[model samples]
Target: MNLAMRRSPWATLTVLALAQFIVVLDVTIVNVALPHIQSGLGFTTDGLQWVISAYILLFGGFLLLGGRVADLLGSRRVFITGLALFGVSSLAGGLATSPVQLIAARAVQGFGGALLSPAALGILTITFEHGRRRNIAMGVWGGLAGLGGTAGVVLGGVLVDSLSWRWVFIVNVPIVIALVIATPVFVRPIAPHQGNRSFDLLGAVLGTGGLLAVVYGVVRAEPVGWSSAEVIGFLATGVVMLAAFLAVEARTTAPLVPLRLLRARALSTAGGALALNGAAFLSMFFLTAIFLQQVRGDSALRTGVEFLPMGGAAILGAVMATPLVTRLGTRPVMMVGAVLNVAGLLLLARVDAHGSYPTGLMPGLIIFGAGLSAIAVPAQIAAVVDVSHQEAGAASGVVQAFQQVGGALGLAIVSTLSTSRTTSAIASGASQSDGLTDGFHRGLLVAAVYAVVTIAVTFLSPRLAPSPEQIAEAAAVAA
Candidate 1:
């Protein structure tokens, strides 16, 4: 037996989950600190965006490459390497003196996250045997990840208020250090697949480049307008590059992403459904955050605290989903979750211009948050249902990439629509609060539509996943 086989599996899982938590946390922790970062770094109003955009661009762009690399190399090696890079970059970002320096650090941090997140998932899937145990593991993984985003805002608020904005980045250092030290002790060494290990240089370049351009364009659309020349140019280029990448993948003998993976019905279906779930879920958070601060007149700290109930609901839903999935299967549970998401969005859409949080927000936030978790846990499980142990990293990367792209694209579209509605309302005779409320309603409605679409896509998933015996047989054949 290897070193890992001797260690406790749950301990191994705890290490992986903590690493992924920090990765997810960084995605939103910076949001609460943006204003402080601007003043500290002397960033221009427009240039301040690069602090966040730099991270999103790199993290979203390099996920596929990171996953494939983990598969080509070894999961434990790649996971540890990612932790070191992420920790070092976080330290650099915390100590930066200039906007340029900070932005550069954030970019590197994002790249590290790209490498770490999927590899962590790959290790988890490999460590746990698929079935009830894996389902429970995924539930914990999915729940913590969902909670991390919500926690980021809350923790960022406390750090920025109590200490300085730099603490947001600095806080990750100790946790990462602990994880790096523990990983090798608890995690097993999964050897790389033995064969021709020729890397797909062309596919990696085109795929990463294409995703970067697309994410950059999507993020830029809100500030610059989708019609802006810069937005149009980047988006057009991204489409062309992505098309070329697909063509290259189809022809390459050793493709970065083997095209055959798409033929796995469960993987494809779950990826699509999760993309839409990401769209609605992220947009809901964005819209609700603004509504609380701008319309409800809550402080940033208070706003973060207010979201706690919803975050708790998400955890509960995640815990509830594991047993339900083991009994009912993935498709039915996914459909129910998607429908609940739509119901929640509609409730949020009806928020009054002047109303209490309990009456106007709690109901919707609780339902939406729970629904989001329900979808996430199952979709994560399904994404790897038919995938072999060797490709777990790549499969995890694909699922993460889909969600990242969806969140970016959905946020852009929903925010644009909301802003236009608010502008129009203000142009007429509406009060500022009323106009903001109208805009939020419009955005929430759009998010509701996205959830509805997710319900439709969930239907494509098989009613039942392969039995544990069948999964083992398949893995053996593939190996």
Candidate 2:
């Protein structure tokens, strides 16, 4: 073991968690700055969404491959490489003078994120033994993961308002420099997976292509009619490619995702629940940002400040989850979270054009933020706890992939619905503000429905009962 690993494992966790935070932060930091970016680069409205989509598509599509690579190579090597790439890409993005340049840089940043996230997670799983210690670490990890995107909104506003939108990307340079300097001193290397299993090149190609096509189709379905030949062709191609990917996985000796991993009821169900949670959670952010700025006429800075409470609430929920999971187990705690999520979304559906933040928005944001933290922490723990060390990266990657894909698909669906409703209301002579508010409420209602389904799924899914050995470990930790 390295001197750092021998002296303090907590140091290693901190470094890993910080890296994860930066990766997740980039996902939403650019959202609030989109208008600025578009105006600066003279981008068409349709082309602007690609600034976000490019990152998500590549991040989601390559995660499994990235995870397996982390396992085949050492985690430390992959993590550092990813950090360097991310730093370079962020610099490129900050210097970008054109729409294409910025979008390309963002896509590369996403690729680096895919490499960093799973490897950091795999290192965490191996560094901390399973039980209370691991649970606590996961709670912290989950809290940071949950906070990153929401906090990004607030940070983006501050940066854009005080400085320029370019500062949002430039700010990462200093942080990345700090992390790189500290990494060798604080984090230790882990052994790679043994045996000579070749990387699944064919599986990676099929899976990446299929996911890209599907996400593209979903994103474009709103601008172009769903019945458009482009939408149908992309969707059909995606499905066929995914089926082929699965076939390849079944036959390959070392698949990108092991088929046996899907048989674990706890992991599989948690992944599904996480996907649904992602759909609702991300939609909440997207719609609320629009409602605050467009309907309520709040400035970007004010919108960011308004979101501060949600971030605090999420951190608190993560802190509380550790003991709750210890006392009640993962399934029950997750079900409670689902109930809170449904209630919060239902309340949010009451937002109107002439509403105030406290009565109309704060209540739902607080409740939903708490619920999101609860679900995210436990779902993350359950997804990897049952898996072997060698498969940890793949498991983490799968859970995160579901989240990215869910967010993309959910945003597309809700945005399409909101646009259609707003257009219809305007056609009927409603004012623009009221029409937009109406559409936002309708979208919130759909999000509430998704939360309700999440509750049902949590109830019906098999419980993640700890094994006897795990129970003993927990008891010892308590003592």
Candidate 3:
């Protein structure tokens, strides 16, 4: 049979995008359902965070290794394997009766996503000839990924309000089933690359374990005082393990992360900025969900509906980003994005117990969404500035991983900040709603600060000339 089995490229792209869509969609789908999940599972406020944190940690931590595995074991095989794992885990999550069960399932789902995401991207890169067609496919892919993220909130709301919060996870089971069946029909099978196919098991374990420990420490600090021995021990353990991970990577033949990539000024700067951006965006969304439902007394459905405009604004920003970057360059676009994010977060910080959504959250939500997408596109481009073909995947993976890991870490810290302030306010004799609002304000203020720092980081991004080839390649790599 001919390579690709002579399958239509669009068909392959569709399959790949759908796979990616599920990966992105899972990130936010659970946010709207969080309240329902907590009530149903009787989760402690501090314990509830693990539902989201577990997924992001495993997904981000395993992502680079997943890509490397796909390269050695074939994209088609890994994609199917990931889909199966996701489907099984989603079913388990839906049926979970305890918080631990649900959290464990989410972690597995994250690992599956780690395996699925890169395989899909790898397939897309190989399927399309590297030029206009590939660029267009990647654009469609990028746009769809954003939509999937925004759509998750809406979809989760509908499912939670109408069916049950369990459906938020159950919904994925059918989708994964369909994707698995469709995979062979559309996605071309590539033979596993023949060579030294060593896996980085130690690095993956140490790195992921270290992050989990640190995030655990942060989460625990909210419930138990930060001075507690448990918190301090976890923090110390995480730091030492991370330090050890670096040492191992420096010596390993097949490292999970190539330390030399940090030497690329553009990659390092953009990666840092992307990490901060991820932190702000993820924490903002998590707090907004709680604010709308718990503080403002909105139904799950209403909260999701309220987020519609923000989602639309985000899509608009993504669509507009390419043209803006093409005309103005990455640095200017990034600066504007950073400013808009700060403005949005500041507006959101004004949310009060007495305020209405229209008067308080709507405008901020819209602007924040737009700013989030705007920064995202340019950062992706800047991260790849002057990168060679050989290092492109590694560089892209590094930044993307930073974004996910940053999001998980950010969520943990911000949740603690918000909870701490809320406790203080409530203890000070404020009304429950007022105390919650105060907490939300603090969290959003911190997100605004992160965005403000992002503005400064944009200056460090190297300028990539708007040449057609460079744009096309960078954009595709970004997707």
The best candidate in terms of TM-score: 3
Q: Which stretches of candidate 3 lie over 4 Å from their true place?
A: 1-6
lDDT of 3 by residue, 183-278 (tens): 988887888878878888899889999999999999999889899999999999999999999999999998889999888887887888888899
Comparing 1 with 2 on lDDT, the higher-scoring candidate is 1
Compared with the true structure, all predictions reach lDDT values of: 0.79, 0.78, 0.88
lDDT measured at residue 216 in model 3 versus the true structure, 0 to 100: 94
Candidate 1 lDDT over 312-425, as tens digits, reads 888788778756777787788888899889999999888885777898788988998889878977787777766776676567667767777676567666766787788789
Which candidate do you rate higher for lDDT, 2 or 3? 3
Residue pairs in candidate 2 whose N, alpha carbon or C atoms collide under 3 angstroms: none
In candidate 2, position 479 carries an lDDT of 13
Please report how far candidate 1 places residue 171 from its true position, in Å: 1.0
Which stretches in model 1 have alpha-carbon errors above 4 Å?
1-14, 31-57, 95-104, 121-147, 181-193, 219-228, 386-393, 420-436, 465-479
Q: In candidate 1, which residue pairs get closer than 3 Å at backbone N, Cα or C atoms, i.e. clash?
A: none
What value does the lDDT take at residue 182 in candidate 1?
A: 88
The regions of model 2 sitting more than 4 angstroms off are 1-14, 42-49, 97-99, 123-147, 181-194, 384-393, 465-479
